[model samples]
Target: MSDDANRHDPAPNLVLGDADGGRLAENIMHFARVLRTAGLPVGPGKVLDAIDAVSQVGVASRRDFYWTLHAVFVNRRDQREVFDQAFHFFWRNPNLLERMMGMLLPAMRGEEAPEDKPELSPRVAEALAGEREPERPQEQEEEEIELDAALSVTDREVLAEKDFEKMTKDELDRARQAIKRMRLPIKPVKTRRYRADPGGRRADLRATLRASARQGGDLIWLKKRSRRRENPPLVVLCDISGSMDRYARMLLHFLHALTNDRDRVHSFLFGTRLTNITRHLRDRDPDAAIDKVTAAVEDWAGGTRIGESLHRFNADWSRRVLSQGPVVLLITDGLDREGAAGLEVEMERLHKSCRRLIWLNPLLRYDGYAPKTAGARAMIPHVDEFRPVHNLDSLAKLADTLSRSESAATGEMVRWKKLAA
Candidate 1:
């Protein structure tokens, strides 16, 4: 057993349920399982630590008990909200079954009581709404069900096209796994630097002489070199504001894949400020990397200051990270709190700094999306490409868009520009 298990508990006789002190430990284990099911990185170790912490601190004060578990389990800022919701639902009442049934079927209690509903995080909501086995009547016999389909679509196809925000827990898990295996087939761009090649148009007198010197100054062979080729640097500027929380979380998985698969990839997160998370994301373990990124970024799920954040990037980081014809992926909803003050100038400067600026907006998932926001209007004209980024299909299309040598002002962007103009 571990040290936690060996340690003596102060609340040895404390019994919240049928069991002795083990009841609390069992409850903590179940909570950890729920968290794992809800996409958290909670493990058995954390559960043990939580039990030990509660035992030492004593759950006399509910607030202290809550924070103790939070300190042990939650390692990232994004996870705090989910943990809070889970704690509220899990420990609200002594009767877990009654509380769950009450929340799930509020209509059964007549219309008198205004439903005391909480705005739960999606992961926590799904976990709390646990599966229920259907009850069968004694008189009923088992029957076979049949379906006649006119058309067919595979689950993978549906999942690829489904919006990230609308995915269930299972589907989201599959999508994360799919994202981990995704690779960007980026084409290499020609550079001024040269490398050794025999079939070169330009003659290399120096290389030819150096090779001939080995053969006693004999001019038996000719040598040549070709310009070096490399994939352009990828600079991602992701938005982590309140409105973008859901989509941003999913995109982080995609970004993690990109960081591991490619080189010269720089990532930045902006809410009210800009944060360079390239180093944090370099960890091979996606869960650990995201945890570190969350701990490092202070302004997540806050208000958006697009203009100010972009201005900061332009002033401090553009020259450092945006050199050598980099392709910039600006992931945002384009909602700015400052009404896009100086946004156009900064956007233009950023556009000029990079070879290609592709703006990925989750709001584009809406059929009636319009660039009515001041930030959108100012930034749209400066970006080379504008695309939807709400699904796996869209991300696949992004890879295609990057591979081809096409005009930046595509049809979708042209129409939007005309409407904004």
Candidate 2:
């Protein structure tokens, strides 16, 4: 290799502690912390690795630095956008330091800054904002304690109805906490298996004879058996496409709670492909579970291919998860990229396979919502229940609905279809 080629080729591993290496390493550490705050799952070990990688490469060029950190920090495709945004704001922008300095001054509190910052996602915004704990006077603290207790109740009521898209970072945290406390109060479905019941309607002749034998043929006692009742499995097919991203994360928290509360709960996430994350959600810690899911899923925040995804589910997963008349919760907006091709067939099959098929669309939160899309129209006819899954109130309603013995009627579907037409 020529001398010019050697300069461009670069060394295999970055050497540490160059002239400006210490300052660069500090910036890298801070940047890693920022990413961790924004929900990227960046750890201290990753931070050190990133520093070392950058040290070897030398951040003489901006592109080289960006790619170096991106390779080290971004683990999932969904995190790419967030990482890019944070990178530009943290390093590339010359005015970010000026803005930070401006924010610290007491006089700048009411004054509008000359430059406006780009809006970040709720998670990112929350991480970058960081936590603040200020000292309070004893008298003021007591007043706040009394006020906070009353405010918490009122706040919960308000949060129940608040839309996921409209919620602030603090509100989102409260919503997650609320969802974690939620439980599904579903009625058990009777199975083919029989269990001995003293007052059962069906008499078991063999058991009756055995009872008589026990009594030495002197007396007879009728023995009865009843169908065993157990909580049916729950299968959730959630859409994690770009459009459903905000609602999906909240719903995952809800799913984690449900998984811990019940038995035989299966979860599959789909964007352009289907991924079974049932094992991932079984983690005891919500953060750890979500992190596992983020690392395991490949097509997160991608485009929607609803028809294809459903077709894949029906063909591959229906037999395994849809046994014993399990209740299916289909969560998506029903916007198919292929114009609802083959959706009707797959939906009909899914409806027949499961005892109850519930379509939970966040769009239904709107008062005048209708099944306007082709995908929505095809799916509306097959679902036993059509409900909104946007807020805590909606989820509570869903839990109540499932607990009831009676499922939703076909009339509701007719009304929706007519409205769509």
Candidate 3:
């Protein structure tokens, strides 16, 4: 064959027996890359696992190969969605590049659905469709099956666009799973006396005297050191109103982590009423604890009655949880649909009862936020510090603030006072 003919022929590089194997291996690698881009955490281990799974299953049929790799690589529920989307787009039999290109158009319009379903561009889709499918009965059946399930395509696209607001029951469940996996670095506050070493410090006089007495009352040197325990009680009041539904659920996971890690973390959730969930959060497993809390809370995603809730907390829970200069985390948006009278009184009481009352508001995530609302106005001055709690970054800041001795007071309170003029 002439050089031109050899170059034009697609099978020139293919060895007779290994032609199919080579193509399957190449496609698997490419599909793995797609899964990685779609946020499936497809690392070298998963890649190796995919290859082994494909080899064991035998690459004779496309459906077997697709499912074999999927069973090995897609572990988590959220990851399964991304993997399924990427797998369909990447392994298309005809007009793959065109389909991918259609997917990319939505992204360019700044309306790309959530990171749940990563789609490709039209140009890219056209490029991928370069290879034609072999005419086989099984291949035709697979194609027909896929076409019948086209409804899933629009569903994924909708999920991507809706973000958190449009999450389905299953998606919300997966989100909660994601939240559980998140690790919050909550350091314990150590007391001054706790740092002293029993052996190196002044001495344990009582122990030394006891030791000398065992020696038949001989003149023996004795040393003594006083010991004080370090236990910084954690007090958390989480808001569970409609406005804080998303944030409150996630925060509950964090609080569960905190409760299990520490000895004295008191947790309470409130919407229309106060419900102490310290015991519930203390359950060893976060999922079980959250389930227990869900069962206990009568007002999940209910109307906000912050004033009323806070008043109840101050009246009943404050004395029990606020002893030992406990650090207070007041998690709320401060958007009391009810009037601020009860909130103001409760805030004042809470501030006095705790060592520091740090207010965490999701509303503060916006840059131009002002405490113009009645609840914000009533509660701002009473809080030792005000901070945002909308995202992971904000939660990290909260961890830092909690670990430290002093609270980082923001000027939003000052801004609010001026605005009230």
Candidate 4:
């Protein structure tokens, strides 16, 4: 429970139906259930709180009533989208329901729906379809295929290609489990610091002198040494703005896995500001770690200020964490609230400070995507690699791609340079 939950009767309550208090409370309780099913953290306590709050506000208007329930149920910013959709569907409005139906029914009818109607999130869609809980999709058994691939198309394969935003509740759970088993292949870089080696090119003159003094003998054996090779420090800068909410949780799982798997990985989450969540991510349990991160970060699913966030990172964190030339993974869609003000300079500075700068943009999943945004254009030219980070396949490919001991592709750089131009 958050501090807000422990407050002295802070105003927020559940209210449903316009008839009577008893019926309104009952319907509101059921609505809370819907929200819980739709991936909200709503519980019995919140329903009670909402009920208590409703008496104070009264059934003034639909807007007031809606807000009263929302305050109690929706604690986190990311949950707002899901809760909003669920509320509209669960309460069952005529015009909105018809629009939702138009958007939902077209696929079954074998035709595309009109673009005018908004589509529902998979979580919201599944929550509303609780006519009966459909059998959870089971993993398909591998079947022999003649196509020269080792594995045929299976649920795992489908999941590998599917966008993180479109996954249902069951699929999301399966995906998280799969991500837990993933390993990011480590790529070590040779540092200037030296360590003792049995057979090496460089002589350890200082060690030999110290050894000779201790032994007090002419028969002094010279020691050999070599530069230490270690996995480069990995620094992740992940965006947590509203535009990125769908991908944020999934990516946090990946970050958590990486942090637990290795050392020297620093993670910072940014939306309107930068937050260092490296310590929180060190927790072994993913859920607990994310909870800690949520508590630490104040700007989750809020407005993006990429330029301002980057500037802050460059000013405050660059020296402390960027030492030893870390490989920086800047994860964002490059949406900036400041419209790219001061972005180019900071990006260039960050690029210079790091050994490699890889920008993982979920927007790259779209085939015809362009750096049309001011922030995207300003930052693109500075990145060593502009890659997609939307699905399991892309993450796996990122692991494989980073593992290779090769320089950045010339054509890739040229293409992005042209795009930025």
Give the Cα lDDT of each candidate: 0.82, 0.80, 0.67, 0.82
Global CA lDDT of candidate 1, please?
0.82
Compared with the true structure, the alpha-carbon lDDT of candidate 4 equals 0.82
Model 3 worst lDDT window (10 residues): 1-10
lDDT of 4 by residue, 166-217 (tens): 9998779888988998999768889999999979899999998988888886
> What residue pairs clash in candidate 4, if any at all?
13-50, 14-50, 14-51
Alpha-carbon shift of residue 369 in model 2 (angstroms): 3.2
Q: Where is model 1 more than 4 Å wrong at Cα?
A: 1-125, 131-153, 218-220
> Best candidate per lDDT, number?
1
Better of 1 and 4 by TM-score: 4
Which residue pairs show backbone clashes in model 1? none
Number of the top candidate by TM-score? 4
Question: Which residue ranges in model 3 land beyond 4 Å of their true spot?
Answer: 1-205, 226-229, 407-421
Clashes of each: 0, 1, 15, 3
All candidates in order of TM-score, best leading: 4, 2, 1, 3
> Least lDDT summed over 10 consecutive residues: which range in candidate 1?
1-10
TM-score of each: 0.74, 0.77, 0.56, 0.82
Per-residue CA lDDT of candidate 3, range 250-354, in tens?
A: 788889878877678889999888898988988888879988998898887777898888888877877777877788888998888777767788888889988
Q: Residue by residue across 150-249, what tens digits does model 2's lDDT show?
A: 4477777998998998786678888898899999988998999899999899998899999899999999998999999999999999999988988999
Candidate 3 or 1, higher TM-score? 1
- In candidate 2, the residue pairs with backbone N, CA or C atoms under 3 Å apart (3 or more residues apart, or in different chains) clash, namely 14-56
